[model samples]
Target: MRLDLPCLGVFFLSVIPVNASIRERLSYQGLFGCVHSGLLDHTGCHHFLRTDSGMEKTKSLIARIQFGKFFAILQSYANKDHFNYVQFSNQAVKMNQDFLEIKRLVESIPEHDDLASELSFPSHMFQLMAHSATFLKDTSNDKSRGHLSVYHLIDLSVRILALHNVRGVLDSTNSISEEKIISLHRELRELVSTFVHDGDSESIMNWMFQDLAIQAEQDLQKLWQQVSVHGIACLSKTDQQKCIQLP
Candidate 1:
């Protein structure tokens, strides 16, 4: 499926990965770099010091990103006609069920002093999934156009995942433990590795989604760069040099 957004083409082209393995590795590195660097500067990373509030927010952000990445992988498969109506429908049903459970969990958290509002399952997200499920169920009989519908579904899913309010949370965070971040990075790498080696369909899908993942990583990099550069610029010349020279 072609994206008509002009800016997106530039973003996608800029971060297109050489292959799935490289893309996965870059993602791991990007996350690690962002979390570490973000914590160094008081302006951006200080928020993470609030362990009680920050931990919950960070976990929710990670979970949301995982959901987005998973769907992006699915989109790549749908784009290549790797999924039939039944398989795609089953996956959608499962995703919706998972989302419902997530919603319940989020709602169970007391609102007194929690980040429940910020971390709650988006209502529109539920609506989108429900619509996709119905569309998949109703169109199961049409084999010829099934791929097209699935492609649209994938597109919608990706779009939702890409929403600033969703995946962008990570870009704005300053909290989270180094160990926790590292562990999440490792999990993402393992997930990507599994997709790359799973089968021809998944291998191809990984390759196709690599560009999308890279674009997302690049955005995070840009955020870090913006903050780091500004912070460095505010320091005295010697201090700036020292900051720049720090490994």
Candidate 2:
């Protein structure tokens, strides 16, 4: 009998009830859990309790996988340009390292510790978003026909990044100061405006690096204004400022 997993929004051929016990559910379906099978155990922690409501988690995971595929497509574009694969691979490696770190931290903390998970998960998502952005910046050439260019991918990455970034800021223990919130929204709106202005590949790649600079500079000035009010600790300071600087 075929079964549809409601929480996962995935279809599976299972001759068992969806409401069955977790152990039995796995057995009846003849499926093995990657988390439980010691694949992700190298980082630490063995057991992972499936979230009661997995639809959202499934969606999140799916988005994460799509981002990976997007990166792959960007790789192909870069390959055609005689671009160094090592450059892109290095960026992805750094993100993966961070991803593992976040995963380790999450395992050390309780699943119910919403604060830790919220802070960490966004970091992981940001890495994915940043990777996509880098792919666009590095590989873009002369292309059209609604093809994925660096700017198109950058816009998509910014959308996802801004969404998760807002979530991260909101989930923090400190009350979100008004100034910081405004800066966040402003930065997001700037990204949105870029998307609106250049919906095509050539235009987006050019605009993302060119027209967006003035707006990005303005954002930094506004951020400094925020820093004056909120202080620097409100931000996640990193030594690698290269990522923040647009190409």
Error at 41, model 1, angstroms: 35
Task: Please give the lDDT score at residue 45 for candidate 2.
Answer: 28
For 1-247, candidate 1 gives per-residue lDDT tens digits of 1232232223232222334365454443343333323234443322322323324324344235335534545655556735654555565565555555444444444542353454444444444445555666576676655454456446534543444222333333333322223333333334334434446553333454444344434443443355443332223422222222222
Error at 233, model 1, angstroms: 24
TM-score for all models, in order of appearance: 0.39, 0.33
Clashes of 1: 1
lDDT of model 1 at position 243 = 29
Off by over 4 Å in 2: 1-89, 111-176, 196-247
* Cα lDDT computed for each candidate against the true fold: 0.42, 0.41
lDDT of 2: 0.41
lDDT of 2 at 146: 24
